[model samples]
Target: MLKIQEIREIIKLIDQSSINEFTFEQDGSKIKMKKQSQEVETVVRNVVAAPPVEVVSTQPQPVPTQQPVQEASAPKTEETKADTSNLHKITSPMVGTFYAASSPEAGNYVSVGSKVTNDTVVCIVEAMKLFNEIEAEVKGEIVEILAENGQLVEYGQPLFLVKPE
Candidate 1:
């Protein structure tokens, strides 16, 4: 488990560093963190593994006992439904690896709450060994960032959410 202080430190580093993406692997766990650009939108994929269960009885359980299990799964279904409609997506113009900054040593083009105009260079998508600058098509304030830096982004994949100004 990550400590609160460590998480805070990570956030601070992200705020201060020019690099937009960072990944760390420790113990048996891995974490990838990225700062999104103002004009781009991103999609987050979460895969949760089911917890291990111990069987106390070899016999089949009664129908009545399964009622609680069915009820518990309902919340997960509702959460998925809630997330479906709450997004404003910014899609990629090409297939490539999404980058928030020009390079690992450079500052990111944008961050959450950043303002952008129609011509703002929001991010760089590397395709066929070439770096392509992605621009915002509309003026807005960045509300959410969707993709992680250095991650493979498909064509038309969302990169950011912008609240129109």
Candidate 2:
């Protein structure tokens, strides 16, 4: 069981950060918390069980309705409207640090309105111990560069938005 103060502190932290998820473990118990929009949900799964019951003679009780509980715990999904025609995004193939140029002193591989061929090296992503040069898959003019230089990026994260020729 968590103290009320601890639960309040976790809620405070969630309100102060951009992180949508948090988990804490202590004293053989774990609590997972998530916040979405204006709602917060917490699930506590205890590892230990209470003592088993002895022989009982009481009559069975009616089960409570679970519809409200389910409604309260449902996850919310946010939708964004995007124009897909004429707009194609270049995504990172692997999780790594994105570099806009070969080095800090070098010119960027591609910029807005830069014409690119299929084999043009658009950027480099450093993964593990190697720096992999990312090439343009389609001949086009770059309309946008989504990722910043020397930024950590996740797999499938959008790196550039291109308008195909």
List per-candidate RMSD values in Å. Answer: 17.9, 14.2
Error of 1 at 27 (Å): 48
lDDT of model 1, residue 58 = 19
Error of 1 at 149 (Å): 0.6
lDDT of each: 0.67, 0.75
For model 1, give the RMSD to the true fold: 17.9
TM-score of 2: 0.51
> The CA-based lDDT of model 2 is what?
0.75
lDDT of 2 by residue, 88-144 (tens): 788999877799999999999999999998899999999866999999899999987
Q: What C-alpha lDDT does candidate 1 achieve relative to the native structure?
A: 0.67
**Model 2 bad stretches (over 4 Å):** 1-84
- For model 1 the TM-score comes to 0.49
Clashing pairs in 1: 40-159, 40-160, 41-158, 41-159, 41-160, 42-146, 42-147, 42-159, 42-160
Residue 23 CA displacement from its true place in model 1, Å? 32
